[model samples]
Target: MGGGNTAEQAREVLMDAAEHLFVTRGYRASTMEVIAREAGYSRTAIYRQFANRDELVAAMVQRTTQRHMVSILSRIPAGAGPVDLLVESLVIVASELVSDPLLNTIADQTADGTIASLIANDSGLTELVKSTVETVVADGTPFRPGLHPNDLAQFIIATALSFLMKTVPAVTDPAVARSYIETFILPAILQESPEPRRVF
Candidate 1:
């Protein structure tokens, strides 16, 4: 048990260094050696914790994403209706991704569409959003006919990533972003309830 705790602590220290290096020096430039040195550990120590740079980066990204999701979920009201919860979650995610320092650094540095690929694949961010979406709709929330929760989650993740990547015209304005989600996105997934719930 003590050894497990020590290992986990070492991994956290390495990840903290990786985050700083990846944000400041850019992802490709922050090699494992430099990350180890930055974390005050020998180069070989990093290998003990992580098989390769990719695994280390993945760990850092997963940690950061989990932290981000915690912040997102906390800001959302506990009593929010299903539509409101989903809309608010998507809006908050888009807002944060646009301004996220590490993600911005990575996106700015990548030339081979790495960020786009991450979105398309079931990466950490996608899985996090999918899990949230499933939770939101778990109470038998009605959707467009025949659309599964997983499909809706994927669509929402794609839309949020598109906003982050600015693949479409930039919805920089919050009002415009909320409107876009409410108008185009909500109607597609959410059934037209007679109650007309306000998603604001």
Candidate 2:
């Protein structure tokens, strides 16, 4: 039992190390040997856990995505308003994508298909977003006319990601990013007369 636990802990460490390296350096620049060295593991040990760099990268992406979902769900307030919940969720997602090294690495990768597959396979995140959207719509805060809650949820998630990818590298100031979301993005998303804005 102790050996199994140790192996699991080592795998987690390797994944965390790989994620950091992959994000700081592009996929091509990150090698299994480099990951092993950074993780303080032997090349053979890394191979025993992960077949290759590609597998390690995939695992890291999946693990990070899972953690983000768990964090978001845990932070959501009980009995909160749907639209409010959705906005908070978006903020959380955006913050995580901006700060998480594993996600940064995956976003930088040119292989869109692989990234899409990773997201699609991760149902927990999608389901949480979908359920939150549905709750908001059902709670009388209907989405913009003609926009399905499901589609809107998807758009919100995708747009938040795209915005982060495009803006984070260019803007050094955190306030600018927050301002853009407040002054532009939020208004565009909320079609109602009284535009929704973050209260706090």
The prediction achieving the highest lDDT against the true structure is: 1
| Candidate 1 lDDT tens digits, 106-157 | 4554445574454456466566666776676754576666776677767976
Clashes of each: 0, 0
RMSD of 1: 4.3
- The 10 consecutive residues of candidate 2 with the worst lDDT sum are 168-177
What does the lDDT read for residue 102 in candidate 1?
A: 66
Q: Please report, in order, the local distance difference test score of every candidate based on alpha carbons.
A: 0.71, 0.62
Per-model TM-score versus the true fold: 0.79, 0.56
Clashing pairs in 1: none
Cα lDDT tens digits for candidate 2, 1-200 = 11343777988888877777777776667788888888888789889888876666666755675677678768888876655565565666555556665565545554445454445444555565667566567534635566676676677656656644654443324445454455555665566634435322
